[model samples]
Target: MSDREPEVVRRLSSYDVTRLDTAITVIQTRDPALARILKAERDVLRDHRNQLDAFATRMKFGSAAPWHPEGVMDWLIAQGWAPPKGLLMAEGEQEGQVDR
Candidate 1:
């Protein structure tokens, strides 16, 4: 058997899932490895989210917190990720029009 413990792998997997979920919710794109991990455990994560409120609750906090989607995106942009244009678009009904 390998010297590495199984618990270590479990913890890493949990951390990876959390990161992927945050990426999907905030950035709408998952890191390549994270995307693979998410795809492999998608069903399990969905079931867990449905059975417990933790995931949903955390999402609410992240969405409402001052340092959240925008903050994350800004930080990522600083790290070289391209800023998403949708982040700058206004919500709700549009007013006025621009002539070409």
Candidate 2:
């Protein structure tokens, strides 16, 4: 095997995401299959936003954490994985509201 084979990716910077998004957008406009697949994914995520957020909260805080629609990324951020945008907290906010 080649030593330069791609390693596992841990994260993508905003620039990397922008590049992929540009390509995906272009392809999605030209290809119906990819567009449909992306649409389905979006629809499913939108439909189950509450459930995913709940599941992720459970993963981080066990069953005690009340299920609020805090968004999936919000729950993920509490568990140490955050998106490029990070949490939308006010200045000096030390912890998530749900963490209480």
Candidate 3:
């Protein structure tokens, strides 16, 4: 690996990352095969986001952190790793919203 790897990756626009993130959501509820495809995509996106954040830090991009997926709970639930009904944020709530 060359030191230029990060510079090459830094070329990835925020929109590119955003599209990957959106794609994950779009396919998250589809057929098992499609959902499986997104699982790998999300992993790659997550790693890319991590690398971007590190690159930003090294370059002192700004006070703002680089973008990252904000769908941990949703992704986990979709993968059946988290409770289907939802996480028990409270006795009568799922993720802090009361179940109706």
Candidate 4:
């Protein structure tokens, strides 16, 4: 993680589903296992917080967003995927720091 702002923003925003395939392509190149996890968890990411918290922190969910439980959820929804239910977020959740 550059721990750099603009690079972080770029990485975080790359998760937008509009560019998801491309992003995952990049992900696959870097970490095939995490890419597999991402493929498996595409629509149901929020529930696996512990493993996600661990794996994600290892994988660096962008190397951008912090992978705390809520932060992981934050990244999920920010990617343009709908939240499962009841966890709907307010706008501007992406204003904070993140990396990939």
Which predicted model would earn the best TM-score?
Answer: 3
What global local distance difference test value does model 4 have? 0.55
| Candidate 4 TM-score over all chains jointly | 0.24
Ranking of candidates on lDDT, top first: 3, 2, 1, 4
RMSD of 2: 15.0
The lowest-lDDT stretch of 10 consecutive residues in candidate 3 is 65-74
Model 2 alpha-carbon drift over 4 Å, by segment: 1-9, 36-100
lDDT per residue as tens, model 2, 14-96 = 45435545656777868978866766655554445545555655666654545533554466677566556554666677654
Q: Kindly report which residue pairs in candidate 2 clash with one another.
A: none
lDDT string for model 4 (1-100, tens) is: 4555663222232244335456567899889988877666553433333444554564464455455566666666665558776465455555454636
TM-score for every candidate vs. truth?
Answer: 0.23, 0.27, 0.37, 0.24
lDDT score, residue 50, model 1?
47
Give the CA lDDT, 0 to 100, for residue 97 in model 1: 48
Flag regions of model 3 displaced more than 4 Å. 1-10, 61-100
Give candidate 2's TM-score. Answer: 0.27
Q: Of 2 and 4, which scores higher on lDDT? A: 2
